[model samples]
Target: MISWQARALNLFLKQTVKRSIENTKDVNKLRFQMRALDKFVFGTSSNIERSQSMREGTLCDEIKLKFSNSKKKLLYVHGGAFVFKTPAIHNNFIARLAEPLDLHAIVPDYPLAPEYPFPAALDSCYVIYKSLLDAGTLPEDIIIAGDSAGGNIALSLLLRARRNGLPMPNCCVLISPVADMTQSGLSSVENRYSDALFSLDVMLYCRNLYLEGANHDLHNEEISPLFADFTGLPPFMFHAGSTELMRDDSTRLAEFMQAHGVETHLQVWREMPHVFPLFEQLPESKAALQQIVDFIKKQQN
Candidate 1:
């Protein structure tokens, strides 16, 4: 059974949010709405200490620099079906990563649909990642992390980095990534009613907007990293809400990573939705945060 919070979330979805699911139809309006959310979501601080600034014309969320020990830099990507959300909207979420790891983080707003499209989001993120290397960040101090679409981006960035001979991050963490964009995964359909937040139709709609003309088949591995080659990734840790739609993405990806000789850890939180650890204001969210903090600490060793 879904929790009371989940039930209320679903009701909100059916009423107000369900309507916006159709935001795919008007890309401009969608961007406008996202801009409004960015005020609260993008520009929001990672709440960490460090020199901070915002850079735009890149991707979805404006870039943010959260200070830390100054030497260690963690790069973060925020997920919104590759359509909605920015760095600020995910500040509370990304900031938690900083809290546990005590590392500086750079989150760039990658490009989104219709206006920017697939290669747009992908390329923009790649650029910022490459910038880190150009700026002389050591491979060991760099950790890549993301939730949902950001998770997918994090994986994609790892693959691209490896393939291009850029130093792979020392580790990566994904929170409920969308690995099989084709939506062909059994969980994509089976877990539909399970996750309190995501709807398959809504995901399909967002996928449609992203891959509209490009790969019609999101399972192509470029859009979804499940089929991508992750042969030489760094150490990793991931968490998934058992009832969440993207749980399998984390599990399956972990299996693949381990199979490929990458040290990996996977945590499954029962009856929760995608990245519930991020909702730290709530009870479950607090417990979830502590677990992730522990995981990151382990990797620190």
Candidate 2:
């Protein structure tokens, strides 16, 4: 059941985020608008101390959560259609995730598309992961997680790491991830009108921008990891809103992973929107987050 608060927030997002996305065609302008929306929706906060650093020459932000113990780390990739910076919602979410488990979340602000394009963001993410390994964080003690496009990068990062013979993380948690960048999934067409946060137009725009320089098939496994082999990946938990256009993205990825004999959990929340866990006001959001925490705990054990 959808809580009243969740429903209300969904409506508000339809009004603000949906409308803004529909009217904005310029990529640069959309980036600015999304950043503003992030502020408006997430509110201003000074709770988390963020520091600047360079990873493989790309600027990244390390979120210093007040409750961090550094015993465990989460490499969180932010989702803004592959362009926008890590939003305040993600910062807050990291803090919440850190509070209970004393987790430290490292957010790498990878270069965006149309400017840096496909492999740039992916390469940057890999650099960050390699740096973590070099710094002595055992792969078993690290977890990789991302939302929306970040989830795309997270999955691709795992594949890339495996191909490079790097150790796998303990697990991965994808929140409304875009596993199939081709956007050919059933929900891509079915939930087009219902998903308030994303539209097919928006998806195409981001895809084109990200895939511009690849000069290869957009469905290439490196581009749309939904096409990749996942034989040896770690356990995964995918959370998606039932109303999300990316609902099938999560479902299909889970199915593929399970087919390969990997432990996969897919949680579909009814009436929720994309990345619903960012809305901590919604009870559904809290419940979904707890599910992630539980999955992480079980993996650790």
RMSD of each: 3.7, 2.0
- What is the per-residue lDDT of model 2 for residues 1-301, given as tens digits with 9 covering 90 to 100? 6899988988987888787887456888787767776664454245566676776787766665564557688899989888676467787787677665557778887888889888889999988998889989999989999999999999999999999999999999999998887678889888988897877887788888888845668677778899999999999999998888999999999999999999999999898999999877888888988999999999998
Poorest stretch of ten by lDDT in candidate 1: 59-68
Summing lDDT over every window of 10 consecutive residues in candidate 2, give the lowest-scoring window.
40-49
User: Candidate 1: which stretches are off by over 4 Å?
Assistant: 1-69, 216-219
Q: Model 1 residue 271 lDDT?
A: 75
**Alpha-carbon TM-score of each model against the true structure:** 0.83, 0.94
Clash pairs, candidate 2, are none
Shift in Å, residue 33, candidate 1: 7.6
lDDT of each: 0.70, 0.84
